[model samples]
Target: MRILLTNDDGIQAHGLRVLYKAFREAGHDVHCVAPVTEQSAVGHAVTIALPLRVKEFKENGFRGHGVYGTPVDCVKLALSALLYEKPDLVVSGINAGANVGVDLLYSGTVSAATEGAFMGFPALAISYDDFNHEGLTGEHGSYVANLVERLPLDNLPHKCVLNLNFPNRPVAECRELRICRHTSAMWEDWYDQRHDPRGRPYYWLTGVIPPEKVSADTDRALLTAGHVTLTPLRFDFTDYDLIQSLGGSLE
Candidate 1:
């Protein structure tokens, strides 16, 4: 497959580079156009107000274009103008953190794949549950690349994107892949108020979705149980049932 790889973790991220090597070794023509700096949690933001810059990054036989914008911008720019040909598959991530539960609402990793799906292409978003990248190896990337190769992606519905998350455990220790649903669990977050050297208060956000609230067989729940989770997501925001009821009452 001709693959377009991108990430929210920037072009130089270890996860992205690992995937790049694995994909190249797998014999897929891979082109990466990613953010020059980390754009995690930026969601589907675009760079409309300012001109976006594209820079080429070549180091140690790895080549990719880095965009000074959001993950969505990289996909949009690459598909619309940067690449000479449309890719057969648009793959985002191998992201450092899992984008499950409410995290999907603010995840640049998932949003990158979402943008590709919005543009009528098959897309997949890959993420790991761990934020720490220590003790990682190319095997993780190989595991992801192998899964991508084996998935029946061509059979996916139009405008659908798959969100895949792996548990923090090593690939060998992780359980079998489970097709799952995204959890509707909410984040129980709190902002920490701290004083700067000047005595000004600044707040830092930190939170977690209570494990008790996560439903069984959902992405978050399964991933926590050391299982790889795959959730097929669609972008339609229409609440048809509500529309019908509201139309009848208002009319």
Candidate 2:
């Protein structure tokens, strides 16, 4: 299968590099086009008015293209220009941090794969829940490689993308891959106010998940308990249930 690899953690991220090698070793053709800088929470944004640049990416002998734009731009350009043909699958991540629950709405890693899904291709978005970066090339990498190689890449379910998050535990400590729903997670956005030397005000954004928002059986909570989580994501944002329940009040 021709697998396209991308990430929000720029082109030279350790997570991306490990996957590149692992996937190739597993006998799949891999291509990469990723943001040239860290784009962690950029979400599903795409470059429109700005002139995007694409250049050769080379580091530690791995070669791919680097896009000077968002993760969605990388996916768009790679499909339209870089690859000779449409890929069998588009895989995003091995991201620097877990993109679970509400992070789904703010993750560029998932956005790249989401863009691929919008373009009518099968996509997978994965992340290691640990932020310490110790598991980039260990069990987490192997688990992802195996999952990709075994997937029905040519015939994925239509109009949905898979979101996978692995726990921060060791390989042997992992319980199982649990197919689950997203947790009702919310971040209490906090700002650290500061002033520049010249007296201009600034604020650093910070977030803390409230205890009330924590649920027992969500991807986010399950992952912390040593289970890998897989959730199916859909793009249809319509509140159809509400619409259906609301009877016609006026013509």
Superposition TM-score, candidate 1 onto the true structure: 0.97
Candidate 1 regions exceeding 4 Å error are none
Pairs that collide in candidate 2 are: none
- Compared with the true structure, all predictions reach lDDT values of 0.91, 0.86
lDDT of 1 at 230: 92
Candidate 2 minimal-lDDT segment of 10 residues: 242-251
Question: How do the residues 1-251 of candidate 2 rate in per-residue lDDT, one tens digit apiece?
Answer: 78899999999888888888888878888899998998999999988999899889776668999999999999999999889988988999889788888787899989888999989899999888777676666556678888876767667677678999878767678889888999887878989999999999999998876656778688888888889898988877888877866655432
- TM-score of every candidate: 0.97, 0.93
Flag regions of model 2 displaced more than 4 Å: 244-251
lDDT of 1 by residue, 165-231 (tens): 9899888898999998899999999999999999999999999899999998799999999998999
Could you tell me which residue pairs clash in candidate 1?
none
Model 1, C-alpha of 3: deviation from truth (Å):
0.6
Best by lDDT: 1
